[model samples]
Target: MGIVIIGSLNMDMVVRTSRAPEAGETLFGQAFALSPGGKGANQAAAAARLGAEVTMIGRVGKDGFGRELLEVMRQEGVHTDYIGQSETQATGVASIVVDEEGENRIIVVPGANLEMGREDIAALEPVIRQAEMVVMQLETDLSMCEQAASMAHSHGIPVILNPAPARVLTDELLQHVAYLTPNETEAGILAGMAVNSIADAEQAARLLLQKGVENIIVTLGSKGALIVNHAGSRHIPGFPVQAVDTVAAGDSFNGALAYQLTSGKTLTEAVRFANAVGALAVGKQGAIPSLPQLAEVEQFLKESARP
Candidate 1:
């Protein structure tokens, strides 16, 4: 298996407006779109779009949203046989608002996603064991994330954990993660510091590394990414693009990084490719809709390499 993503699946309800509304103040939206998203699902789709064979393991409600989510995954070529259906919980959903600047604010309701339990992971053991790499996120139950990471770690499979929604994670989970991809804010929270620049990111990543993460990649949006390992750190500059929406940019990076790493690219090269992938993702809208296919990514990289 190429990549196995164990996390959440949600339908995104997005509205475009000039900016986020003030407290109790509503504004007229410019547009709206319903898109399939969930950190796990997004990463899976992003990798698949880049020519990686991906598999998804998560839960969705036994509703229309669930059906559509699974169907969409199938359309993206993600293996969805391991995805479970929740009996009591509704499918997860995200309420998002995009501004004229392409910035977005989101609130996620994790319904069926939280229903994923240890038993479900047990049932999915064979699939997990077969993966060349395991991708995960914090959108699901923290216990489930830890369990999956532990399982893959024991089997000597590399694990890429996207600590989103910003939480201070336990070392138990960090030790198992081969790659911990956190945004600037996430890195700050994890290290009990304020990360506002490359220097700050380096310090935060070092602190996080002491927590036992094999490596840390701090995504600094347009500034690029900082790679921190036992050997120290290096910053890979980002590819500038006309960002229509920043949604899924980090997911796109994680997926592309996993793809390139498993394909034998070095960490620096993988991050560079992932940066290009993220640049492509931000130029569009929605989550899955923003991911670029392999040819597009190749062409983008080819063009970017020009003088």
Candidate 2:
């Protein structure tokens, strides 16, 4: 069975700068570019490139961006038959600013993503139930996320929730997540503490585990990721690389994890594979454009293992 992703799709407008402009201040940017992005779309494309059969369920506007978004997904081998078009809303958009260090700040205008409703989830029941895993993000309406989780849980399907652009999660939603992948900042919000280090991430993961999530993986950029569960915890060390753009690092990680886990790799092994995927992503630029294919990732791991 393949992976099912129910999330948002957006076009990203990125600007490169020395530093993020101070509030109410305008400054000249060094460069600008447009790319296909959105936590959901990025993850789906990443998994597809890594050889997973992927089906994406979401909404896009009835506009050029929407058309291009579907084209990109089709080109990447992600099934787009479930993606819907909205008549009244424009496609979602994210305005991103990346510093020379590859750090970024983003503002997402959800647009048509907000149009995804509970009805859509119900309609996609067969698709969700048959998948090996159901992946989702906070980019879409919380209600839709909750509905998708609930449906997946009812059918005994594993659910991977990447709480990006973090928001407070409710108990009902937490009940269904088989794996919760949150970055340090999002971990802080969910765990109600500052997650600045591996120790802090562990604390945050423990807190989330107590809240009913079966497992938690806290993504620490450059430093790596920490996975915690009933068995114990482990810090998967990151591969050092000079990052050109960090826009989709976490998405790449999440995508690779889902693919590996469903392909019979253990959780620890999957995370290690995911780290390699993330390392490759930051070394390049753009979102979907930066996702590495299976052969590329394998070659990267092979070369990195050299003495």
Candidate 3:
């Protein structure tokens, strides 16, 4: 089965700063760049680069950013037949700042992204039904996410939910999610517990499993990621690299995990592979531009495999 990505596509404006700006304080940026981004688009690009036949279902606008974003996706080999254009609004946009510590802060304007409705999902039912895995993020409308999850579940396809920019998700949403990938902050939000360490993350994961999520993957940044299943929990350590930008690392991890999982690898193997992918992602610049290809990932893995 192929991979279906139901999410958002946006133009990202990024700036580099020495530190995060204080409240009511403005700081001059060292550099600025524009790129094609959005959690959905990032993940789709990541998967496609990792050799997955990825189909993206999202909306753009009748704007220059939309045109450029679509062209970028096409160049990356993602199927964009389901991606639409809206005349009523501009495409989504994300304003991001990367700090000296490689950390980032972002603000998103969900223009046409928020307007994706059940109708959009219904139109993609046929494609969704044939997918091995359907991946989604919280960048789009919650109603659209729920609809896509419900439709995929009905066809017995596994659904992977990346509940980023975390919010209170319903039990119904969790029930349909075969895999829930959340960062530490998002885990705490959904599990209603403080997650500061691997142990704390494990506890939060258990709470989410009890809440009906079949499995949970909690991202721990430089500490790597924690993969939890019915059998047990394991921490997949991240590779050490001088990070240039941490932006889109989580999205890379999620996409890599989805690609490997659908390729018939075990959860642990998939997570280990994803950890390497994420490590490589952060050591580079830009969002979609930083995603490593399958050959690059394999070479890195092989190099790291040696003494």
Candidate 4:
């Protein structure tokens, strides 16, 4: 009803290490944990925590990880009634290594996620049409994103496209995106330039603008985010938080942004709320476990001064 997310669901295998090993040099890690993650699930849980009606559509393998993924979504109040189960592939999994500064490196093996095809999207045509907004990421098959975006756009539904696990995207696909949220590195790759600073981001945003995306939001991690559109560009500073584990922080931002936008907040206001959500996510651990509830966000906003 509020938003539909067509993305991936993976079980995160995380290890905490003092530092990542050099190429071919193995190092002992500090700790390890497993949790439900994947960009789609994180965003779905985020919006649900913020009181948005979230419907998630994707594919997971017919395995225990698949069942756990669904269970986590249901617990977060995300509607997973339409998700598919692939018989041949395994459930998607992400191998993550988080360092002391809360920075992380991730490698995703998109199992059943990559198995989703046109038939799956076609089956969810009604749900796509009914959504107030449709959100997607690059975790699954690019064609699936193309198909879903086109269908949502044709129905006049605004689509929020979060390009992550960065890669080059076609202009044909960008044209259907109402809002494009990409981090600095993703911006650089998509715009064919190196984004070394905020100025570089501005230049890249201009290039991305030409691709027909209505609005572009380039996240800057703790420094904040930059927004660009026909109206011009501006930077929104982020909150200062002592981050412990940064996994799923951006997903939190995207999820909160969608929730605030659907709740009638302006773009700037939505980004600000999302910044707070992201800030809260980093002060914890795991993926879904780190996403703060609505009450937590409210209290954090009241207690902590914005940066």
In candidate 2, the residue pairs with backbone N, CA or C atoms under 3 Å apart (3 or more residues apart, or in different chains) clash, namely: none
Off by over 4 Å in 4: none
| Regions of model 2 farther than 4 Å from truth | none
Clashes of 2: 0
Cα lDDT, model 3, residue 236: 86
lDDT of 1 by residue, 1-307 (tens): 8899888899999999998999999899999999999888999999999899999999999999999999999999999988999989999999999999999899999999999988789778888999999999999989878888999999999999999988868899999999999999999999998988899999999988888999999999998999999998899999888889998999999999999998999999999999999999999999999999999989999999999
Q: Residues 1-307, candidate 2, lDDT per residue (tens digit)?
A: 4999989899999999999999899999999998999999999999999999999999999999999999999999999999999999999999999999998999999999999889878998999989999999999999888989999999999999999889999988998999999999999999899988899999989999999999999998888899999899999999999999999999999999999999999998899899999999999989999999999999988998899
> Each prediction's TM-score against the native?
0.99, 0.98, 0.98, 0.98
Task: Give candidate 1's error at residue 6 in angstroms.
Answer: 0.5
Candidate 4, residue 148: how far the Cα is off, in Å: 0.5
The CA lDDT of each predicted structure is 0.93, 0.94, 0.93, 0.94
lDDT of 4 by residue, 1-307 (tens): 7799999999999999998888999999999998999999999999999999999999999999999999989989999988889989999999999999999999999999999888789888999999999999999999888999999999999999999988888898999999999999999999998999999999999998999999999999998899999999999999988989999998999999999999999999999899999999999999999999999999998887645
Worst 10 residues of 4 by lDDT: 298-307
**Residue-level error in angstroms, candidate 1, position 98:** 0.6
- Give the total clashing residue pairs for model 4: 0
**In candidate 3, which residue ranges exceed 4 Å CA deviation?**
none
- Which ranges of candidate 1 are over 4 A from the true structure? none
